[model samples]
Target chain A: MHSEKELIDGCAKGDRAAQRAFYERYCGRMMALCNRYAKSTQEAEDILQEGFIKIFGSIASFRKEAKLTTWMTRIMINTALNMQRQKLYLLPMVDVNDANLYEQEEIGLSDFHFTELIRMVQSLPDGCRIIFNLFAIEGYGHKEIADMLNISEGTSKSQYNRAKSLLQAKLKAEQKYENVRGQKL
Target chain B: MKTSEDRNFEEEWKSALDGAEMAPSDHVWNSIDLKISHAEQGEMKKRVLFYQRVAAASILFALCLGAAGWFWNYEDASVKSLASQTVGENQKESASSIAKVPFSNQNSSNSSAVTITESQNANSIKSAVGNYENGVKTRIENGGKNHALASEASNGSDIAAMIAPADKNVLTLGKEAELESRRTSQSNTGFENGSVTELATNGLSMSAIRLTGKPVEQIESARTFKIAKKEQSPTDDQNRNWWASVNGSGGAYNQSSSSNSVATSLFQQSATSTFYAAPNSKEVGVGTSFSYGMSMGKKVANRWVVMGGVNYLNQSIDYQTNIVLQDASQSKAFLADLASLSSNLASTNPYVLRNTNEFISVPLQAGYLLLNRKAGVQLNAGVAADIFYRNTMTDLSGQFGSFSQAAGDNSVYRNLNWTGLLGTELSYKMNRHYQVSLMPGFRYSFNSVLKSSTGSTINPLVWDVGFRLKYVF
Candidate 1:
């Protein structure tokens, strides 16, 4: 039942018991964030492992004015991006025109379970998946996402729109199947 | 510029996934823990190595100091024994010369021999006196007449000729001779056989052996006998006070590990993949340090000395870079021109880069002797102005060869650097003219070796063990 301050102080001094406690307190929430950006569960675990290592290494530099969770979350996002940067160069990201931003459609994600939502997000293309997680879930603007990924702002918006359309189509087909199954039953 | 529908869509997605909790596999924590342990081990090794270098230097200094003390004491004992042996031999020679001199003028031939002996004795004594005054070798001939009979006989065979010139007369009883022995021997005292007699005449003393029945060859050998002469001590001269020393040292040079931004940035961007671990400050290590110099020191006071000299100092460092050849594409900053010239950069080879910095350092130091004796200990503190000469970067693996940059030739290092020095010298006076010393010292640079604009701070510290040989004039 140590306080957050005591836990942070202990972790900064490289106390293993405090680090394990710190991990247990924040890993589950951080794992969900990692899953949103990573394409697979294994990749998400890889990102979480690297992120925690970085957090422990640099915990002494953490400013007390910010929440520990927010600091740890930032490290997780950066770790995920670092892993993605290697692949982005091999599989080049496409640049879209500004007119492609108009093709976005509104969709309801309430009908799906959290696991099903993660699956649909993971099924998107690498560029779309990263851009959508940065824009839609991480609350970053298109311009910020473009700078982070080294792409054009229009490309970030176009990738987000494409992710939304694909999820919309998947949700619509699932709803149609459910209605047909109800009639058959 | 966001629409209300777009805002709602993003908010819904954030709320849905942000609170979603999922546990990672247990192996992830284990991997993180392993990496941290390895990094800690490397840090511990670096700390241990630093202390080990200091300890080694200290042990060598202690051993050298102990040996110098022992040898100095041995030389003192040997000199004392040699002086006693020379005294015993001189006593026997004096007694024999008195017994062999011809004392009788009973025949015309004996009278002529007496005249010849007196003339030769006068010439030998005059020559010996002249040489002694000139601070040169004093060799008395003609059977040790004046010195052996007057000086050795009266002083009980301990004193050689303690002669002081009396006007034109060079042969007389010196201050060391006893009045009673001079008066008794002056009365022409005869031996038990009445063939040997002591005679004093015309400011000359003679012990004549009247071998009237003996062969001429035996008399000739006795007449040619030459006594060993002791020279004046060098300590009596005030001019032989200055000393010169030549010294050599071997040790390690350490840099302050806190600021290594230049090396860090170079290593971090070497590999494109995050799987390979990046090199840290601990990997930048001391390689070798060596210096040799000569200085002239004089005892300014009873226990203090001052010296200044020039030294050629060389320090080296080993940086274990992370730039493997297979990952050379991303690390264009290192050897970029060579990389562009070659098409094949796919080898997964690694090499260590050794950076050597050479300097001409001038040290002005003052020393204080804590124990000033044959075996002595001195504490020295000083400062040096080190001028940069050149730096050579060589691939230790022999693959990349080497390159060098001299001062003001597009070098990143500063031209002038200041260093503080402290040392303790354990010295032994081997003899009147020679001494040997063991000096253990530490040096620390006050400013960075590199330029301020380079954003790299490198203050080097050196621990060395020096051996110095000194000669007193």
Candidate 2:
């Protein structure tokens, strides 16, 4: 297997074998990252392919200052964001005051599987889901998220808070249902 | 700055999603590959078109310059020829006056009878001789005085002396004489020294010949002298200080392919070589070329004209190839990846590559007049630098066949190359100012279009035929 530098050089030259090796090495992680921004598996795959094409085309300009995976992840996220923006632009903006903030629920993290967590995140509205993912999982500041999404910093903060409250309420409801089912059993 | 509750939620989500993985379908890669290929082809086409436009503009500019130069030259030549003709007529009149004095004196002195009939016969003879000499002198003066003096001095020195005014009276003949002379001398003399002074200054022996015969016989002998003088005049070659012309030409060009085995080996070594293999199998069609220019020439010698000017050349070559992909299965696998990713790869056909390369050249050339007459021929040769403007190639291999690529890197090929030119021009003078010409020419390149060590080469040899309209000044 080639090193990151060699892989980049080969990809720049349009070497199919090197491109395949590079794809295989990073596609799993990159796809998982894509899944966070996408609403469905198909959408995630589209973002992944778009990101890879960008990576291959611009490999010649890639500087080694950042990790290759980091660069690829950034590209995937940006591609997904661009697609989301196109779709989301037509939809009406949700006011922060309109969001229903529920009480926080004390549920154990272990109660939810990784797949269940992904589904819960995906279920959020496009605006809130994007904000939550950027802030919570991607560890970006509200300012950066606002810039990336072309929204105000206050909107990013409010949307992130709304996403958290909604998820907490759902987890609390699921735990309560489980308790009732256990009694019936 | 996150609250304790927010921190806890973030940690929970992070741990839950940790090590998560999902594999997209293989079809995604296939779609990406197709997109890249299409982008490349589009870029190539755009570049080729750009170069083509540049070449065309350059040629057009050159043609305009050529035409403007020719027009200016024609107008200048017309003015000059007219001025020279007027001066020639004036000199003829002065020369005839000198020629008439000797003939009239001989006729009058020879007639012995004072009877009106005899005197009238003598006057009639003098008038006939005067008319004959007027015609001869006009032609001789148009031939220039040096030629006339050189050939006719021995036979007509007395007549020459009679016409040459004494140095003191030559310029001071005053308004009356000048006006009278203009009326009397049909061919005027603008000569600085009168014909009499010209003969005396040259130190030629002036002997009067006595005629004892009929006046009609003397006139006949004079006519023979005029014919002999016309034959002795120098060949008519206008030595204009400056001349200009405009010309346009078109021709066919062929570019020789590169022969570097090393680069060919490298191309074959790579499994996914973007460079084409078996370039020779591809057809390189005949190239189209055009050029236009305006030149200014100086008459350096009796039969030599030296000229230099700017010329614009637009040249283009077309190359087409059908390249078979080495591994069909591998491509299928790539497409499968893209399909799995939910992106479709539309094309699976063999790749067809088409490329067009354009160049604009500016040349400075010098021409030598091999023949000069009402109809003339010239030979010209020069060297120029050519600028490679664009190289565009389209690849149509996928099912949709809409993929294109433009090579934007001029350094990949020889952006600048030297050209050697040789040509011959045949011209016909329509009048004093306007001339029409047909030029056949050839151009040879000193460098290949491809950069050194690329294993691919394109060296073009061009032949051209041109029609030119010229105005001489």
By DockQ, the best candidate is 2
Model 2: per-residue lDDT, tens digit, B1-473? 88787888888887778778878787776666556655654564455455444434544544464565556445434323322332233344333322222323343342211101111122222222233211112211121122112111223334233223221111101011000011112123422221211111011111111122222222312211110111211223443557777878876665666554543554455464343433451344456577787777666765566666556666654333333322334232121101112232333333434444556666666776655656666666788777777654434332222222223442455768898987767778887778898777778898876666455566777767777887767
TM-score of each: 0.42, 0.47
Cα lDDT tens digits for candidate 1, B111-149 = 112111212123323322232221222222223232332
- Docking tier of model 1: it is acceptable
The Cα RMSD across the true interface for model 1 is: 9.1
Q: Which stretches of candidate 2 lie over 4 Å from their true place?
A: A13-17, A97-102, A111-113, A169-185, B76-80, B94-473
**lDDT tens readout by residue for model 1, A87-120:** 8889978765445444545567777788888887
**Candidate 1 segments whose C-alpha is farther than 4 A from its true place:** A97-105, B57-473
**How far off is residue B419 in model 1, in Å?**
39
Tell me the DockQ of each model, to 2 decimals.
Answer: 0.27, 0.33
Please give the distance, in angstroms, between residue A118's alpha carbon in candidate 2 and its true position after superposition: 2.0
C-alpha lDDT (0 to 100) for residue B251 of candidate 2? 67
